[model samples]
Target chain A: MHPAISVIFFTVTSGAGFGLMTMIGLGFPMHNGIVAAFLSYLLGGGLAVAGLLSSTFHLGHPERAWRALSQWRSSWLSREGVIAIITLLLFAVYALIWMFTGQRIAPLGWAVAAGSLLTVYATSMIYAQLKTVPNWHSKLTPFCYLAFSIASGLLLAGMIGKATLILGLPTPTIIVIALGIAWIIKSVWWRRADTIGFSQTGSNTGTATGLGHLGKVRLLEKPHSGENYLTHEMVHQIGRKHALKLRAIAYILGGIIPVIMCTFALFITPVFFLLIAAISMIIGLFAERWLFFAEAKHAVSLYY
Target chain B: MTLLPAQTNKKLGLVIDLDVCVGCHACVVNCKEWNTGGYGAPLGDVDAYGDNPSGAWLNRIHTFEVTPDDAPAQIVHFPKSCLHCEDAPCVTVCPTGASYKRSEDGIVLVDESMCIGCSLCAWACPYGAREMDPVENVMKKCTLCVDRIYNDNIPEIDRTPACVRTCPANARHFGDFADPNSNVSTMTRERGGYDLMPEMGTKPVNQYLPPRKKSRPEETTEIAPAFVPKAGEGLLGWLDRALEKLG
Candidate 1:
């Protein structure tokens, strides 16, 4: 559970990107003509591609990443990669048709929408399937991912709409509602995660080492004095006070501030406020994603 | 590929006796030594002699103080490597077909050439058995000394895992667990051997024998002090004074 910056960036950025793509596919903002359609797709596609590429940056051998798609039959990571590639390719084609013909194909749009959402789900499954990390191995993990995607996607779509003036902004009420749902999912996720380590259902040192019958088991000595890959990768710690502060920042910036901004956008400069909300949500989500990895307790850490 | 075979012909794994192991870490060292040259990738070290040394190791020994109720505390030397589980999560989680459990012998291995080094396999493993080799950028793990175990080049007596061959205490044993009469199986049945993290449900092939309870003498024997103070031994050095005060 090291809070790897690359993975954090990848999850948050890609979640937003897929969310935006989902919104585009749903025919929101009513994009027309080459410039509007091109800009919309570029933002969505560019963010998606950039996030995907950043995910590879943490790989020991990024060049070998293509081989990851081969084991989708059993591996969630492979499934995510495969599904993501297909989603992006199909979305690209759909964007191209829209950009050139200026016609929104309902069937293709629906397909892209489903594909985009599925890609997000697959990405979430990559974490959720890890029974080794009890915090992530839950139905709520996928729910949180999907909820965040829709929330961020809706906000980005509204921003794109405002920037292009192709159509009036999406109902601000809807944006606020999406943000509310996302906040609720996130609150539940954080609460569940916080209590999991102390929960009876979670793994512990005694159960991990099969020494519960011995009463209390404590480490007398470690294997080595030096650090190893396990210690470096899985034994991350964050202060409680720091984490609390970050959580507040994440909620306020990622959810509350955006909701407030959306609520007031109609009363003030709608464009400026919507744009601010979009940026704030992303930055806030970045903090939340960082905490997601930092707070997770890997079962392997029990041995250490 | 990543899909595990319905059944393995043999479950070849290790049985570690916590009662006998002295926490010498000889198995850990020998496993790394033999595997560095034998396996898919050389087990490597970064900043080996520098301020902060980090590396990939196949085997690790953890010493834990186990205090049983109504019993004296005992230190248990726990040596952990790959369990080579019947339901190996690491194998199924590998994005490439790099990680696989052999249906023939049930040895889980990483096909280094195919590994993308994405590290999802490591995350899935409850034992922290697989490590990402910083140098090769591929997963490195205990192959259970696959090369030595099956090699004709080595002497018959030496045809086992490097760790087992090198254990001075004879605490480590290697054999097939599938055969009812196998030494490992018999030992497991007799010793009440248990799997680590059974709750994780990996159904690990490896088993660990718990440290046996200590037996105290029926009668306490009080012996005379080793040294009798002489008539004029009033003063001594600071070290002697410190020892006297400790006494």
Candidate 2:
């Protein structure tokens, strides 16, 4: 799947945004609960909008994205678009109601939080439904997306904590714990994906020739003169050694470093550790997201 | 208008006999000939005589040789194309309503005009059935010759798919899968047909019957004809025989 940079950014940014919003909406009443609650809405709302806007750049016709929301009944992509927009609307309404009434609207916030989570589920299902691509079809993929979002969201919340002195000790602790748990889930997901063998032969040169008898097949002949659409779209040749190095970098920088920094910050200066953790997570997740796309093998590659 | 009653028609499909296929490629040529001139748009080919030659082909034949244990080698000819699966992943993944499965006949089709050329449907297909039409920049696949199958101008007997009509071996058969009494369904039931990559669970409408096996004859040794000695050779042999008797 020639992991387009635009899509990579879209998933990570939007995933983090949605993840953060759901967590904040759920944990609104923790410390300086009112102010923390408001901040959560603001930060989560802003990031979600930013992610959606960035995703539009990938579309050839951004105007057509509007029509995408109409087919939620059948299409997961359409459902995702619809769910995302609805999440935003619900969050806004929840915020407005809270601001005007001063007292918390528990039912409304809970409903909006549920909607935000559904948006994430829909986003994950878009990839999971594709049975041809073994890598994306796993049940773990959606869970991984959900976990990564929450972890990224927690890291974001911790960063927010540093800027403003809200609920002192317990707040940062909770965020760090969430980040740690997310890190573990991602690690397990990576390991599981490694164990499963690809169902389809990555190259289709032999399959096309109808010689399944041949145990091993190499590129015996070039199918065409110049690059065809199949070759360009499917046979993305990212070096194996380079991918291994990138995975290490993603794990250390995106996973380990943030966890350590966040954990350390809980005891030491909350602001210092929080800032480092937040920055590390943002950078790490971007690398992780890039690898997620780069490493994924589309079944169409069999043709090449 | 609720003028006509909702008639439940079973989706028709093809069950190719791989064992019987002769790899003649009659189906491929016939399909190209039928599709190019019949449909909404011609299956365009760029640079037919120039350096690079490429065009849309609905059916392709691939020949393979399989060697079984304690048996002579077997040649299997497979005709490759869309299986038209019941649970088509291609339809679900399309962001636009462009790709859809018809409830009336269960044929998975792409609305070329509505397609945004995202290539998601192509990625979703396991069989590599969907090909991007570079000219139109939209996905293309076997429409089962929909435009020709029901044409009133064509005779009822001749209205079958071009590929089915052209197959000299009669390896290809097409009929409504809903009717168990149909020729294709009965043949499949009797022969115990199988779908390609059943593990994927696409529930492909097209089934492939295993190639029939042939028995081998027993091996035997060959013997040379009896020989007779010439006059000179016989005399030399007699002298040698006398010498041997004397010794």
Candidate 3:
């Protein structure tokens, strides 16, 4: 499971984007009292769309992304796409309601907010349901995705607050607290993942014959000479030590630095801490996402 | 209009017995034969009689020598292919709706026409089951011989998969795993079947029974040397003395 940068960026960016949108939708009632409701809706909606556009670049065929919605009966990926579209529609309706009424519509706002969270769940289940990838098959995956969305959302919200000069400093302070908690959950997941050993017989080379033997199984002969589709797709890998260092970098930049800066902002001015946390989170999560892919041991890699 | 119902009650899978599989590669040969001729495209072999002969195969047999720390080693043959997992990664990772798992029966399959050949499904699969049909430029895998299994035109007994049908030793079984009383399920339970790479947690439906251990062979006693050299051979002793002087 060599984690491709494209997917890592897609997950983290889209996750944060969805989180921010949901928060804005949930907090729309507060928007009318503190700031221009239209402005909040526009900004939140725009950011969510932008994040989704960024994620589309990772797809091999973005045009076909629409067809992905058709298989909701069986595929989680399809469900995620379908839910994302539904969330967007709900958000749009919620915005129109807020603009005309000059107040948050309780049912619409809550529904959209819930839908946004469901989008995150669908995204997380895409990985969590995989039984072969031990690192992903755990309760922590969905929890981590949800927390990561919240953490990223808070960072974005805090920045928006600073830029708008709304809600004073307390808004960013609360966001920082949320980010800190998210970081702790991610750290625990990382520790737990490290302790689990992979089953030896699962390797493609070993299991291809269905022998549970513990003896050394090397690629005595490849089934193909040139790179077949399986070899090309599954055998891609990076060294283990490189992935370890990258994981450390991701933890520090994506997890630790954002927490520290957000905490500092709780007592200090919101502007400085918000900017630092947002930037650090984007960078750190990129690394974290990359490590997620790179450190993954695909059962297919056994053939190599 | 042919309505391939969106779902069906076919839990198609392979049941491989670890005890009997001798790593003969008969399954691999038969699988290639049946699938290449019957399906979307032929499993192309680039250099058949030349330097290299490589082609796509739904099933591959692997041989390994298993040795416990304190026990003697034994050869075990493992036949590897798609497990048709309940929670298949290949289905989720497909950007296009080409790869899908059947809700009716837990068969993870790909629609060749819908597939853009992105190869992401291959990356998602821990088992090296899915392969690109070079001729069709679409993803391909063992279908459990979907067309063959359900065809009423064929005799009921011959309706089984090509590989299962061809197995001389009856090493492979095909059935609806959803039914608890199914032969495959009962056999698996009674034999204490194990999934390949259970840690991956893909929840593959196919299970492999571990090889049954055989009793140890009788130990042979060590025999002493047949003949002792009498005071070193007379000629050899003289040569040794001469060689020592020369040194």
Candidate 4:
């Protein structure tokens, strides 16, 4: 996997947006202009749209993107697109009521929140459903996505809610818990990724050639004298040292830093500190998302 | 719509004999030549005829050296392409329904017009069957020569896939596997043909015939007569002339 920057940004930023929507919508009673104008519209909606648009950059035919939504009955990618549009529409309606009427429609707000969460789940399933790439095909994948979404969303809300809402030990405690849970889930995911791979599907060269009965199978020569689409795309062999270094960066920046910052916030209670925690966490998650794609081994690589 | 049919009327597929394969890339070249003009035409290439050349190809041949415990090392020539699986994840995962398996012939195909070329189908396929045309930015794979097989203009004998027709060693066989009496079916039964990656449960229509067991050396072996040195030739005499040439 090349881990295209467009896709990485799309996943992390859009996930944060949907997570923000879920939190703000769920807590609609705090219907200040800050929550409605800044949190919902500026932060959540802007990131979501920008991320969605960013995803199209890597497409071969961005013009044909509309056709993707038609296959919702089967494709997770299609489902994600549809859910995202619907969630965004719902948020638009909820935003209007909040801004104009100066009142919160509790039901509409909750619906937007649920739809946003579902959109994020659909995004998670885009990778989770791929059995060919066993690393992403697990229950932990969605759990990781959901946890990260909420954690990022909470920090976003925490960054803005100082004037309107109470800032104390409780919010930092919640962030610490979310950070702990997210990293724990990510660790378990890495552990399980090793156990399940292309070998589990019996797609080795011996089985590939159907010559295991004859002897051990090894590549005498590659099919092409030079690289082709399959070799270049599927056979991405990241060095162990680079992957380990990236993993450490993700854990330290994404997981440990946030926890430390939140713990520090317990005594200081500074908005600037929470803002820095949010930025650090996003950077950490950016690293994590990059590793997610870089480390994934496609079963097709077995043939190459 | 992605739900697979209970049964395809004809499981049209290829049976490759590993024993007969000489590791020549005739099938690979023939497929590229025919498909470049037949359908998915122009099989686009970038940096072609340059320092590096890369392009989309429907079929490829892989050569492997295998060494069994207590046995001699054997060279296996394996040709691979789309299996057109009964449970093709590529088709199911295509968001635009561009990737499809025919209910009539069991041949999986891609509709380039409808394809957004997200490469999701290629990701779902375990065989490395699909390739993206960088120029066209669309996914491509073996179509089982749909146009040639059904065409009325071509001669009946030549109405098979270009790969099957061009195999110099006659290793590639094409027919309907659904018909028990078909050549492909009978050959599979007699030769113990097996599916590739059965653990994935895609239920590939194509089957590979494993290499035949080698026969042991006879106990009573004929000995060759010893060579006699030429009357005028000697080791010192040969070195004298050869050394002069080297100088």
Which candidate should be chosen as best, given lDDT against the real structure?
A: 1
TM-score of chain B of each: 0.87, 0.82, 0.82, 0.87
Worst 10 residues of 4 chain B by lDDT: B219-228
Task: Estimate, for each residue in A71-121, the C-alpha lDDT of model 1 and write its tens digit.
Answer: 999988898888889889888899989989988787888888888899899
- Model 4: lDDT to the true structure: 0.83
User: What lDDT tens digits, residue by residue, belong to model 2 across residues A1-304?
Assistant: 6677777777888888887777556645433446755766777888788877777765545655675665666778878888899889988887766655665567776777787788888888887887766667788888878887877776676666433323554656666666667667777767766755454333243443334443333333333455545555565666333777777787787777877876787678866787787777777877777766666666645444
lDDT of 4 by residue, A147-252 (tens): 9998888777666654333343477777778788888999999888867766556667666667776777888888999988876777766523388788899999
DockQ of each: 0.63, 0.16, 0.18, 0.58
List model 1 lDDT by residue over B1-247, tens digit each. 9999999999999999988999898998898889888877788889989999889899999989888776678788889999999999999989889999999999999999999888899999989999999899999988999999989998999999999999999999999999989999999999999998888889999999988756544534343333446333455565577787898
> TM-score per candidate, in order?
0.92, 0.76, 0.71, 0.91
Instruction: Compose the digit string of candidate 4's lDDT tens values, residues B1-247.
Output: 5546678999999999989999899999989898889876478889989999999998998888989897678788889988889889888888887888899999998888988888888888888999999889999899999988998999998899999999999999999999999999999999999988777778999988888876544433333223333334698778777877998
Candidate 1 root-mean-square deviation in Å: 6.8
Per-residue error at A138 for model 2, in Å? 2.9
Docking class of 1: medium
Question: Candidate 1, residue A265: CA error in Å?
Answer: 1.4
Model 4 complex DockQ against the native: 0.58
Q: Largest TM-score belongs to which candidate?
A: 1
lDDT of all the models against the reference? 0.87, 0.70, 0.70, 0.83
Worst 10 residues of 1 chain A by lDDT: A162-171
DockQ-best of 1 and 4: 1
Candidate 3 lDDT, tens digit per residue, A110-181?
Answer: 787788889889888887766556677778989988998887876776666433323554665566667778
Measured by DockQ, the strongest candidate is: 1
